[model samples]
Target: MRLVSVDIDGIERPGAVVTGPDGVDRVLELRQFTGAGSLALLLADDVALDLTRTAIGRADHASLPRLADVRLAPPVRPQVILCLGYNYRGHVEGHHEGHVDGETGQDALPYPNVFVKTPNTIGGPHDRVVMPIAATDVDYEGEIAVVIGRTAQAVDESDAMSYVAGYTLFNDVSDRGWQDRSSQWALGKSVDGFGPLGPWIVTTDELPDLGGLQMEVEREGVVTVRASTDSMVYGVAFLVHYLSQIITLQPGDIISTGTPARSVQAQSAHLPLADGETVTIRVTGLGELTTTFVR
Candidate 1:
């Protein structure tokens, strides 16, 4: 089932997208059922979601709201946003002059190169990605974001997938100049609204093999990034397990599994995002997320 955070009548509530009796998609508000303030609050409430899913399946059409009437939020307000750097072969070994070599001599890196972005970075799926004054060459890194369902520490790779609640789309907007200037990436990555995530979270039950999904990003009607989740140098299960060893993974914490190699820098013209241009990231099963850039 697809879970969404919705804004209706100035109140934010948790909802699920379900087809009604008319065979039309509608948003079923789960507030009455789950008694949760937000979707983020329900990540660990698996039993609540399971029951809600069953109820939604048999819910009356008259009781549901038209999907168009509700405004979508960022889906979840994550407590922490951990991002993987150079997990994709194409991104690590870019098709450019300054690309890094991906030959680690091993099948994968010893561990995932992880970085943290502040909570302020989160923005609604369709929200505008503000071009900060500190930024000049802002580019998009469209990725698949994993939401943790339960608290975990030192979880085994074999069981890490069980901790995942769902998947969502994320755009890791970066300032190329700032990113390259320092050895650390947080300065270039954590500007407010830099992380545009979600339209909704697709429960892992509906998408078991998360790595098999396809993802792509578009800018001004041109497809710029295209790749499959299977291309990650360190796949989802490994990253989660590795991260758990260092820090406890809590519900609503997001791990943005690395992005594929496609960005404005890859354009023949070498252009970064400009004001008024919109970037749309689409992960096959997870819904599309759009972010318009602004000054």
Candidate 2:
């Protein structure tokens, strides 16, 4: 079931998207539809409920309110946002001038390249990504964010997937200049409202083959990034296990699995976003997340 957080009559509420009795798409307020109080509870369940049988019950899609009318928020308010860098071979190679050589060319990174963006940076679909005055080159990196369902510490690689609640889309907004100036990536990545995620969260059980999904980013209706999850240098399960060894992975914690090639940086040599431009990022199963840049 796809769970969404929506604003109804000025109050933010949890909702589930289900087809009603008339085979129409409708958003059911969780309180009215199911005993589940929040999306987090639905995610924590091990058994997937047949949405049609329980909440949806075949209603007319036209009967539901238009999704655009509601104010969107991140599907879940995460305690922390763990992000991975250079997790895609193409992204690593592209940043180094299209050369993938390990010995003498651009692909010579010594580590896995990890970083963290604070939870305050998180926003939701239709949120605005503020282009800081300090940044001259703000770029968008579209990535698949993994949401952890249970607390995990020192988890084995084989058991990593068990801790995952589901997946969502993330726009890893970056200030390229700040990133290059500082030895640490936190300054460049942690800008408030830089990370925009979620229209909804899709449970892991609903999507069994995570590796086959595709991700893409579009700027002002033009596609800039396009690639599949198959290109990830390190998979989700491995990263969870890797991070669990060092830090505790708690429920509502988010780990962005990294972006694919063809992002803003890869397409343009040195172009940064201009004020009033829109960036849209989409993942196969997950929904689209759009952010408008403003000075």
Question: Which lDDT tens digits does candidate 1 get at residues 160-239?
Answer: 99988988889988877776665666777878899998888898888875767788888887888888877778877887
C-alpha lDDT of residue 127 in model 2? 77
lDDT against true structure, model 2? 0.75
lDDT of 1: 0.80
Compose the digit string of candidate 2's lDDT tens values, residues 85-125: 77776775436221233543214565556788887888878
RMSD of each: 2.7, 3.7
Candidate number achieving the greatest TM-score relative to the actual structure: 1
Count clashing residue pairs per candidate: 0, 8
lDDT of each: 0.80, 0.75
- Per-candidate TM-score against the hidden true structure: 0.91, 0.85
Q: Candidate 2: how large is its RMSD?
A: 3.7
